[model samples]
Each structure stands twice: as C-alpha cells, then as structure tokens.
Target: MVELQARSLRVKIAQQWGSLGLPFLLVAVVILFSFLSPVFRTQFNFLSILRFASFIAISAVGMAFCIMAGEFDISVGSMMALVGVLGASFVPVIGGFAAVLTTIAISSFLGFVNGIFITKLKIPAFITTLGMMFVFRSLAYIYTDNVSVYIDNDFWLYMGNGRVLGIHFPIILMVLCFVGGYLMLRKTPFGRYVVAVGTNAKAAELSGIHVDRIKIAVFVMVGFFVGISSVVISANMGVANPGLLGQGYEFQVITAVVLGGTLLGGGNGSLGGALLAALILGSLRNGMNLMQVSSYWQQVVTGSVLIFAVAINRLRYTLMGQEA
Candidate 1:
C-alpha cells in the first residue's frame, strides 16, 4: 500500500511540474544570472531583457495559436523581411501610421494565401510554407535590389525605441499581446475551436467546427504578429536589410513556443509558458554575452536547451498518462 501511495504521489508531483516547470526554471535562471553578474541584477539590464524578449514573445503569441491549430509557418522570417522593407519604403509616401497598417495588411494577405494553398490545394503545410519561405525571401531581395531601406519616420521609430514612464514601448506591446492571446485562448469559442481542430480535425469537422477556416485564420494570425515584429525590428535598427532582417527568426519563435510547453503535435499550449520561455531565452543570451561567451557557443547552448525542452515535453506527456 505504501509503495502504491508513493507512486501516486510521484505522479502528482510530475503533473505539477509539467504545469509549472517553465516559470520556475525562468526564476531560477534569473536568480543565477543575478548572482553571477552584478550588472545582470541592475534595473536597466532587467528592462533590457524585457525589451529584447518582447520581440520573440509577441511573435510567439500568434505562433502558439498556429501550433495549437496543428499548423506550421516557417516562412515568417522571410515574411518579416519582405514586410519590413515594404512598410519602410511606404512610409515617405503614405506616412508612418498608414504604412504600419499596410504592412500588417500585406502580411495577413500573405498568410491568407498560405492558408489557401494549404487548405484549398490540399498541400501539406510544411511544403507550402517551405516554398513560400524561398519565394518571400527572393521577393524581398528583388524588390530592394539587395539594399537596405532606411527608416526615418518618427512614429515608425517609436514603435521599437520609445519609452513610456520609463518602460519601453515594445515591452508594453508584448504584455498587451500576451493578455489578448490568453483571453482568446482561454475565454472564447474561437480559441476552443482552434484546440478542437488541432486535437482532431476529423472530429472537429464532424462537430461543425469548420476546421479549414480555423486553420486559415490561425495562419493569418501568425502573419499579423510577424508583421508587428517586423515593424519593431526595422524601427530598432533604423533600416530594413533584405538579407539580414529576420534571419533564422522562425527557429527562435518556434523554439520559444515549444519550450513554453506547447506540444509540437498540437492541441495543448500555454501563452504564459511561451512568455516566460521568451524571457528565459533573452536572459540566457544577455547573461552569456555579459560573461563574454562566444557567439558560436551561444548557438550551441541554445541548441542544447531546445533538445532539453523536447525531452521535458515528452516526460510531461508521459507523466500525464498521455501518448507523446
């Protein structure tokens, strides 16, 4: 009886860990970095981490939704590049606000196209997005002639570099995005439909969920968020370089989504987990940089962390009595 009780207790502990592990790990990492480097504990550095994490976290919000709908979008990196260049180029003619709107609209349209190809043509998401990735990147280069478009608009610049009451604008935007994502995921019928579709498309369709529509909407959401990030990134750098902007961004955003406890297979996800994971990644990079770690070594560390995240995800599934 005692042995059986202990086993049950262990299972309960594991279940709790599965739910709360990322936040705890984030706290532990912050504390360790604080102790290791006095600068890391400083207010400025703390805010810097938030600012840096905001870029990934904001994009991760839509990614969480996309992943929850059992879809993938690897073209986001190139999408951002294309949108950034297009948006910046439009600023002088249409003004900053209008250009921002144009950027998001174009991105949403691109995402809609992706969804149409995936759903209407019945192409696999991987192949559709993979092909789009090349197409989008090539368009950016062709349009820009391999040149960087400099951004000079005051409002456009403020999106990334502005501070309000001593807090960066991007950080505030990140918080708002997460809050909105949480509400959408936890409080709405659409959110429920997304999960239903992801969990089992056939079942969801049978229940009148319009699975294809949900998938399309989620892809559009992914594009919308990536559009926001593109604006912020170009604003921060004051230029949009076709070849350099958003390079490898898909990996980073997906890593945050997966690490935050979202299953790659779909159905289950955590917006808060993704937020914390983004902060953790930001902190890790900042701390490593402070310690003078090499860029190559940072890549190695990030890769290892991704592997560990996958292992933990499987363990969490096992602990919850689910197939991984």
Candidate 2:
C-alpha cells in the first residue's frame, strides 16, 4: 500500500507538469533567448518585451474567452482598424473622449451582430466572422479614403505611452484585463455557463442555460478588448492608418491563445497560460530582432510555433484519454 501510494503521488505530479506543458515551454524559450542574446536580460529590453507581450496578452484573453465558448472571431483585426478609423474621424468633431466612447460602442455593436448571425441566423461562426472581417476592413478604407488619420491629442497618445510607477499604462491595462477575465472565468456563474456551452452547447441549452446569450456575451466581451487594443495600437503609432493598423492581428492573437492551451474546438482554456504564451511569443520576436533575423523568417517561425503547439495539445489530450 505504501508503494502504491507513492506511485500514485508520482503520477499526480507528472500530470500537473503535463497540464503545464505550455508554461514550461515558455520558460525554456525564455532561457534559450537569454542565452542567445546578450541584451535579452536588460531592463529596457525587458520592459519593451513586456509592452509587446501585454498588447498581445490583452487580446489573447478575449480570444481565449471566445474559444472557450466554442466560437471564433476572425474579425478582430479588421474590427481594430475600423475602430481606429472611426475614432479618428470622431476626434475632430466630438472630441477625443467621446470619440473613444463611440468607437467602443460601435465595436460592441459589431460583435453583437457577429453573434446574432451565428446564433440566430444559423451561420457558422468562422464564416460569419470571416465575412465581417472583410466588411469592416472595407469600411475602414472607405471611411478613411485610403489616407491615414492623424490624431494630435496628448491624452490619446498618453493612453499608449504614459507610465504609472514606472510601468506603461498599456501594461497596467493588460494586467487588469487578464485579472478580470481570470476572475470571471473562475468565480462567476457566467463563466461556468461559458465552459458548459463550449463543452456541449446542445446539452447546455437543454440544461436551461441561455447558451446563445452566453455566446453573444462572449463575443461582445471580445469586441470590448479588441476595441481597447485598437486604441492602444493607434495611439502608439501616432496615427490611424486603415491599411496598416491591426494587420495580421487576429492571427497573432489567436496564435497566442492557442499556444496557451485553448483548444480550437473549444472545451478548455487557461488565462494564465495565454498570458505566458504571449510573453513567450513576444520574447521570440524580440530575440529574433536582436539576432537580426529576417522579417519573413519571423513569420515562418511564428507559424511553425502555432502548428507545433497544436500538435502538443493534441498529444496532451490523447495522453489523457480525452478528445481534442
């Protein structure tokens, strides 16, 4: 009995490590990068890495929520562009504060529409969101007339650049977003509903859980985060260019979330994992830049990482005798 108990304890420890494979991988990546680049451990480089990681992590938090609800929002990239363009357009008329408010409201409404099409019109989320992506992207171009809209407001710039207690405001906002998302998913009944719907939507509906409403709420939540990211991106760049803003953002955010152990078919997710994965990705990109790697190679490396992560996820599920 003593031997059996010891074996059981060992198995349990192994399982815990298995569940944390992504985080372990992140740590390994950090160590590798630290060895590869002399500047990787510098304070300035660390803060820079954190800033980029924070942006990706904030969006990944929303993406994780959507994936956990068994849905996809490919429109996130275009949504950011549209929000930036619309907000820039409003700045000259309604002032910066109101423009930001209106932009967020519009983003929320578009997200609601994406949910309505998927839940009410019986469209697949992938299709709905993919179509909306192009629609918003086109609208952004038309609205901006193919030109960059520059906002010279100090407040808007501060949202992206201001530091509090030596930490960037965007980094603070990112931490707040991750903490709030983690708490909601772990402590709230709505969070349970999200997991339930993702685990089995039909069963969730049969259980009298408003699955559609929950799904819509999830999409809206994603939209809110994307809206915040849009503001930060535009502010950081000092201009809102429909053509340049949020390009390939959806891919990066989704990659971070998936790398964090959020399954594609969506039964499970981990906010902590997502944040760590985002940091890993940021570190990888920064490290490559330090190494003077080509931009094309960076894209290839990122894509390869996503594919490898998915394979690891599949193996993990299979090892645990669970369907991915």
Candidate 3:
C-alpha cells in the first residue's frame, strides 16, 4: 500500500510538471540570480531578459507544435540564415515590408518542400531536415559569396529594437505569439488533430485525421515562426551574416521546447512551459555574463541543462508508466 501510494504521488507530480513545475523553477532561478547580482533585479535587465527570451520562445511555440505532431525540423537554424540574407537582399529591390513578407513566403515554401519530401517521398524527417540543413546553409553562403548583408530599413529595424509604451516590441511580440499559440493548441480542431496524430498516427489516420496534411501544416508553422525570428534577429544585428546570424539557433529552440516538458516522442506539449524555459535560459545566460563566466563554460552548462531536462522527462514517463 505504501509503495502504491508513492507511485501515485509520482504520477501526480509527473502530470503536473509541465504546468506547475516549470514556473516554480523559473521563479527560483530569478530569485537566485537576483541574490547573486545586484544589477540582475533591475527593470531594465528584466526587460532585456524578456526581449532575449522572446526570440527563442517565439520559434519554440512553432517547434512545440511540430514536435507535438511527431515531426522535427533540424534545418531551422540554416533556414533562418538563408531567409535573413535573402530578405536583406530584397530590401533594395522590394522595400522593407515587402521583403519581410517575401522572407516569410520563402521560408514557408522551404518548409513545404521539406514536408513533401518527408510525407510524400516517405523520407525520414531526420534525413530530410539534415540534408536541407546543409543545403540551406550552403545556399546562404553561395548567395552572399560569404558576405554579410547589412540592413538599414527603418521598418525592419523597428521589428526587433523598437519600443512601445516603454516595453520592447519583441517582448510584446513574444506574449502575443504565446497567446496565439495557446489558443491554437487548446481551442481548435486542428490542434486536436495534431495531438491525435502525434499520439498515434496510424490510429489518427484510421479515424480520418489526415495525418500527412497535419504534419505538413506543422512544418509550415515551424517555417513561419522561424521566419519571424530571422527577421527579428537580423534587425537586432542590423546585418545578416550568412554564417553567423543563426548559428546554434536550432539547438537553442529545441532545448527550449524539450525543457518545457514537451515529450520528444510527441503527443504532449506546453507553450507556457516553453516560454518560461526560454526566460530561464535567457536569465541564466545574462546572469553568467554578469558574473563573468566563460563562454565555453556557458555552453557546457546549457548542454548539461538539456541533458538534465531529458532525464527528468524520462523519469516522468517512467512514473506515468509510459515509454520514454
């Protein structure tokens, strides 16, 4: 009876981890950082953290959907690089607004191509995205001749660095994206279909869920979000360097999604959790910078955190009597 009670308690904890555990962890991180550095608790610093987190969190929203739908897009980092450079190049010919729209369209088309190869060609997602990753990065380098395209458009600049009512635009964008993501995931039939497909594609197909269409849609979403992120990032930097703009971006977004309690095997996800996790990461990096931690060590710490998150996920699965 005692063992059974303990098991039940563990299951309860597992069930609530995504919604409850992540928030508490974020609070704890904030408190710890506030104590460690007097400058860390300032409103400016807090807003800065939010702005930084917004970049990863926004993409994480789409990544959550894709992973929940049982697909992965490892090419997003390269996609951002290619899209950023391409959009910046378009600024001279099409102007900023048109360039931004073109960026999104191009990225979406790339995602559609990925989906076609994965679903129609029956290629594994891993292989398809991996190949596209190399292709996209190469194209970016080729297009620029290994050069950086500088951006000077006022509208493009405002997207990432502008402020409204004293709040950073990126922060506001992040909140809006999360709200939209929440609504889409929890309040729509498409959301239900995604979950059903992720949970079991064969069963979802048997029930008429249109598994291929859902997967393709999710991939498109991944592209759409990444396109937004690319614009923001390039705006912030005022230039799009094909090689550097989105370096290691895929890892950061994936880490945020996984740490947010989205199971790698799909069927479940948490946008709130992803948002909080992104903030946590931003805070950690900011705190480490304040404390003068080495960049290499920061990478080590971030990687360790991802490993810890995966372990926790496995434990949650075990406690809930689900396969890891």
Candidate 4:
C-alpha cells in the first residue's frame, strides 16, 4: 500500500508539472528579457505590453470557445475586417451606436453561416472556415473599393484612447472576456456539452446533446466577440483599413491559445492560460521592438514558437495516453 501511494503521488506531481510547464517557460523568458533589456521590468512598459496584448487576447477569448468545442474558425480575422469596414462606412448615416450593433450583428450572421456550412452542410469546420476567410476578405475589399474607412466619433475615440479607473478600455474588455469565458467553461452546462461533443461526438449525440447545434452556437459567439475586437482595434489605430486590418491576426490568436497549454486537438483549454500566453507573446514582441527585431525575423520567431508549442503538446498527449 505504501508503494502504491508513492506511485500515485509521483503521478500527481508529474501531472501538475506538465500543466505548469508552459507558464514556467513563459516566466523564464520574462526573467531573461528583464536582464537583457532595461525596459522590460518598467511598469510603463508592462502596461503598454498588456494594452497591445489585449487586442489579440480578446479575439482568442472568442476563438477558445470554438476550439474547445472541437471546432475552429479561421475566418474570424475576416470577420474583424467586416466589422471595421461595416461600422466605419455606415456610421455616417445610421449613427454610432447603430453602426456598432449593425456591424456586430452582421459578423454574428457570418459566423452563423460558417457554422451551418460546417455542421448542417457537413463541409467540415476547417475547410468551411478557411474558404469563408477568403470570401469575407475579398468582400471587405470589394465593399470598400479598396479604400479605408474612418469614423469621427468622440466617444469611440475616447474609449480607444481614454482610460477608465486607470485601465484602458481594450484591457478592460479583454479582462471581461477572459472572466466570462472562464466562468462559462468552468461553471456552465454549455461548456460541458462542448467538451462532451469534443471528446466524442457520437457518444454526446447518443446522450441527447445537440452537438451540431452547439457548434453553431459557439461559432456565433466567436464571431460576436470578434466583432467587438474589430472596434477595439479600429479605435486604437484610429482608422479602418480592411485591406491591412486583421491580416495575420488569426494565426496570432491561435498561436497564443496553443502556447497557453490549450491543445489544438480540442476539448481542453483555459481562457486564463490563453490570456497569459497572449501577454507573453505581446511582451516578446515589445521586447523585440526595443531591440529592433526585423519584421521577417518576427515571423520566423512566431513560426518557431508555434511549432515548438504544438510539438510539446502532442508529445505530452502521446505519453499520457489520453487528453492532456
């Protein structure tokens, strides 16, 4: 009995170590940078890093739900562009609040369409989302005639540039999103159904879970948050350049999620973890900026991080003989 207890303790320790492995590495990076650069530890620098991280982190929050549900939405970047262009273009006539609602509503519809194609039409989530990515991307250009849109709203500008209770609007939004996602995933039935369907669709269906409907619902939720992200980005940047906006954003959010100990294979994720990863990535980028890292090198670094994170995650799963 003592030997069995010892084995159990060993296994439990290993499990915890595995879980914290990513955050540990992240902390290591922070320490290394703090030594290499004087700006790394400054409160102002970290605040700026968090502000930039908020944009990508916010998007990842939405993407997390779909990913945990064993589905993916590559078109969220395009959906971001859609919101920016749509909101910027229509605000002149329809008014500011109306424009926000309209843009978000349209993006939600787009997400609904994506989910339908994947679940109802049986096109597969990856393929459907990938195809829709191009479709929405092209639509952004066509709708805008390749022109940038701008809004001249004072409240929007203030939200983008102003701070509330000493916190930036984008950061506040990111925190709220992370909190909401964490609660939903940890304390709600919908989250359970998502995991059930992700673990085994046939079993979930047998158990009376509407797997496809859940997928659709999650997709819509993802798109809805993506719509908000567009506004944040637009407000911060002070322009809506659809042609350039949201480009590469999808990959960035996906990379952050995976790096945070979320498995790409699905049904396992943590909004808190993903948010932390997002902050790490943003810090890395900010550090790179201070060090004057080249744009091409940044891509190389991102790709390397993605490959390393995914490889480690897959290996952990293989060794565990189940979900990690």
Candidate 5:
C-alpha cells in the first residue's frame, strides 16, 4: 500500500513538473538575473519588464488560439506593422478612438481573408500565412508611402505609457486579455470546438463541428488581438514606421507560445504557460540589456530558444508514445 501511494505521488509530481515547468524556469531566470544585476530586482525595473511582456503576452494569447486550432499565422508581425501605420494615419482625421476601432475592423477583415484562402481555397496554413506576411508588409510600405506616421496626441501616448495607481495601462490590458482568453478557451463551447478541431478535424467534422467556421473565427480573433497590439506598439514608439512597427514580432510571440508548452501541431496548449513564457522572455531581454549584451545577440538567443522548445515538445511526445 505504501509503495502504491509513493508511486501515485511520483506521478502527480511528474505531471505537475511537466505542466508547470516554464514557471519554474522563469523563477530561476529571475533569480539568476537578480544576482547578476541589482536593478533586476528593483520594482521599477520589474514594472518595466511587465510592460514589455504585456505587449507580447496579449498577442501570444491570440496566437495560442491559432495554434490550438491546428493553424498558425506567420503574418502577425507584418499585420501588426500594417495596422499600426493605418491606425496612426487615422488618428488625425478620425480621432484616436475611431482610429483604433477602424484598425481593429481592418485587422479582422484581413484575418478573414486569410481564413478564406486557407479554408475555402484549401491552401496550407504555412503557405497562406507566409505569403500574407510579405503581401501585408509590402502594403504597409505602399500605404504609408514608405515613411512613418507620427502621432503626437496625448491620448494616444497615454494608451501606451500611462499608469493607473502605479500599474501600467498596457499591463492591465494584457491581464484582461489573458483572463478573457483563458475563460473563452476553458469555459465556452467555442473553446471546446477549437480544441476539437485541432485535436482531430475529421472527427470534429463528423461530430457536427463546423471546422472551417471555427478556423475562420479563430483567425479573426487573433486579428483583433494583433490590432490591440499594434495600437500599444504605436503608442509606445510615438510613431508607426512601416518598416519597424512589428518587425520580428511573430517570432517572439510564437516562441513564447511554444516555450509555454503549446504543441506546434496544435490540439493542446495553455494560456497560462504562454503568459509565463512571455514574462520569461521579457525578463531575459531586460537582463541581457542590463548586462550590456549586444542587441544582435538577442535574435540569436530567440532562435535558439525556439529550436529548443520544439525539441522539448518532440521529446515529450516521444516519451508519451504519441506523435508530435
């Protein structure tokens, strides 16, 4: 009886360690950074890390949905750039609030286009999104006349930089996105549909699930999140440069989601894991800056992390006797 109990405890701990590994890794990174740089442990610097993490976390939540639906969006980085430039351009003519709304609508429409091409046209997601990436990025340049749109409005600035009771607005918005995503994915019927479609589309379809519609809806959902991210990014930078707004953003968010233990092939994911991974990434970047590491090396680190994450997932699948 004692042996059986001990085995059960071991299994429980193993399960927990598998699920909560990223948080532990995050804690370890924090401890290491704190030791390396006193500023790493400071409240102000901590808040700064949160601020940076918020942007990626918001997008990662949406990206997580896409991955969970057995699809991915490589165009997110370019989509963000296009939305940011477009949103910034409208700020002067339509006012800040209207501009924001317009950008989100455009983002949704673009996502809808992507869904149509993939679902209706039967194009693979990899090809569709990869093609859209260049198309959207080019459009941003064309629409903006290859220049940056400068928004000097105080309200726009406040959206990115303001704090309420010492908590930054972006951070607040990030938390809200995460909570909303978590509830939707875990509680709602739509969430179940997403998982079902991802886990096995043929089975889900035979079971009366609208797999195509769900995929489209998820694409639209992620577009909305990307729109929000574009606004925050534009506000933070004070300008929406077609070339710079969201460069490399897709990789960062993808890395965060994958590192958080989301499967690349879809079907399984955790928003909480993505959130923690985002924090870990943000913390690492900050720590590296504090250590005077060159900015170029960050890209190398990101690439390495992505490779490592995919490998880890593959190993997990192998151990579980499942296909990755």
Candidate 6:
C-alpha cells in the first residue's frame, strides 16, 4: 500500500508539473534575457512591469473563474470600458467607493443577463459574449461621448496611483484579488462545483448541483473583477477613454489565462499560473521595448507566442489521450 500511494503521488506531481511546464519555460527565457539586459532589473522597469501586470491580472482572475466554470467572456474588454465610463461619471456624484460599487453592480447585471442567455436560453457562450462585447463597446462610446474624463486625483483616482513600499496601490489590490480568488477556487465548495459543472454540466446537474445558478455566479463574478480592473486602470491613466482604455484588453486577458496552462476546454485553472503568465508577458513586452523592438515586431512576437502556446496545449492533450 505504501508503494502504491507513493506511485500515485509521483504521477499526480508529474501531471501538475506537466501542465505548467510550458509557461514556466517561457518565464525561464525571460529570466535569461534579463541577465543580458541591464535594464530588466531596474526599479523603473520592475514597477512598469507590475503596473502592466496589475491591470491584466485583475481581469485574468475573473477570466480564470469563468473558464473553470465551463464558460468564457470575451466581452471583458468592453466591460472594462463600461466600468471606466461609469466610474468616471459617477465618482463625482457618489464618491469613490460607492461609485465603484454601483458600476460593478451594473456590470454584474449585464453579466447575469449573459449567463441567462447561455445557460437558460441554451445560447453558446462564445457567440453571446462576442455579441455583447460589441454592444458594450457601443454603449461605452455613446455614454462617454467618445471623450476622456479626468478625475481630480480624488479617492477614486488615488487608488490607482497610491503606493506602498514603492509599489502602486493597484498592484497591492491585484495581489489581494489573486489571493482571494485562489481561496475561492481551491478551498471552497464553489470551487468543486465550478470544476464539476465545467467537466460535465449534465452530470453535475443530475448529481444535485445547481448548474445554472453556478453559471450565473461565475458570470457575475467575472463582471465584478472586470469592473475592478477598469476602476484601477482608468485611475492610473488619469482619465478614461473607452476607445483607448480597453482596446485589445480582451486579447491580453485571454492570452494570459490560456498561457497560464488553463484548459481552454474549461474545468482547470490556477491563479499561480495566471499570475506567472502575466509576469512573463509583461517582462517580455518590457524587455522587447528595451531592446528597441518596433511596435509591429512586438505584435508579431506576442501573437506568435500566443499561437504556439495554444498549439502546444492542444498537442499535450492529444498525447495524453493516446497514452491513456
């Protein structure tokens, strides 16, 4: 029995390691480059990386939950824009915390509607979220009048720029968010239900899981996170410009989530991996800029990495199936 248990432990360890090996390898590459570049470890560069990581990391945490719950929300980019606009407009009237809460509440409502369409109406998640993405973008533009609104460095604004130990407040908040998210996904019954629902919705339902409720919860959670991200990011930038603020955010968040070894098919994800992947991407981008890589070249490199990473995941799953 001891030998049997030892073998099982070894296999489990190997499987976990295997899942994360690619992203770790990518990180190793960045570390190697940092050694060659004197600029990589500078305080400025490090803070810059954190600033970038905080924005995407917040959204990725929510994305992780949604993916684990057997759904995806490509609409987060637009949702971020929505939150930014709402927060900027409402903060003056309602104060920072209240304004933020109100915006998140609205975002959650929209997400709940999406969930109803997905789970109750039997609409596909990808299609519904994609459509909502456009709708939100349009709403953001119309509501904000395609203009940027700058806050008066008030409470809402300060949250993004405030610092502790030379790190921005948003970074601290993002770390807290990750810690909270990790607990929710790993230490709670909701975590089990998330994975169970993702793996087999019908089976989970038959086993007494409230699958629809779980799906709605996941969407609402995702919305709240996206809203949180928008609040921090818009403040950091000193203003909100929907067109510029949220441009390509969905791609960035999705890229980080998938690169972190989250199963694209759902039912598996890890905050540790997501955090690491965010760092890796931030480092790579910062490193390239230091190396004087052109913006077009940066896009090429980023795109290539995402494509190759996803392809590798697919191949890994295929081989596992064969081995089984």
> What TM-score would each prediction reach against the true structure?
0.96, 0.94, 0.96, 0.93, 0.93, 0.91
- For model 4 the local lDDT of residue 149 reads 91
How does model 1 fare in lDDT? 0.92
Candidate 4 at residue 229, lDDT? 81
The better candidate by TM-score, 3 or 6, is 3
What is the C-alpha lDDT profile of model 5 across 249-288, one tens digit per residue?
9988998998887887888788998999899899989999
Pick by TM-score: 2 or 3, better one:
3
Q: What TM-score does candidate 6 reach?
A: 0.91
Better of 1 and 2 by TM-score: 1
- Residue 162 CA displacement from its true place in model 1, Å: 0.5
Give the clash count for each candidate: 0, 0, 0, 0, 0, 0
Error of 6 at 252 (Å): 0.8
Q: How far is candidate 4 from the true structure (C-alpha RMSD, Å)?
A: 2.0
For 167-204, candidate 3 gives per-residue lDDT tens digits of: 98889989999999999999999999999998899999
Candidate 6 per-residue lDDT over residues 160-244, each given as its tens digit: 8888888888889889999999899889999899988988889999999999999999999888888888888888888888788
By summed lDDT, which 10 consecutive residues of candidate 3 come out lowest? 16-25
Model 5 clashing residue pairs (backbone): none
Better model by lDDT: candidate 1 vs candidate 6: 1
- Candidate no. 4 TM-score: 0.93
- On lDDT, who's better, 4 or 6? 6
lDDT tens string, model 1, 1-324?
A: 998887788678767765678878888889998999999999999999999999899899989999989899899999999999999999999999999999989988999999999999999999999999999999999999999999999999999999999999999999999999999999999999999998889999999998989999999999999999999988989999999999999989999999888888888888988998999899999999998999999989888987898898888778766766
Better of 4 and 5 by lDDT: 5
Q: lDDT for model 2, on a 0 to 1 scale?
A: 0.87
Q: Better model by TM-score, 3 or 4?
A: 3
Inter-residue clash pairs, candidate 1: none
What's the lDDT for all of these models?
0.92, 0.87, 0.91, 0.82, 0.89, 0.83
lDDT of 5 at 32: 97
**For model 6, what is the error of residue 274's alpha carbon versus the real structure, in angstroms, after optimal superposition?**
1.2
lDDT per residue for candidate 4 within 1-324, as digits (tens), equals 997887677556545644586678678778888998998889878778888899899888878888888888888888799778988888788877777778778888888999999998999888998998998889999999989998787655554666888778888888988888888888999989987877778899999999989999989988888887888888888888978889988988888887876766677776777887898788778887787889789778867876887777666665545655
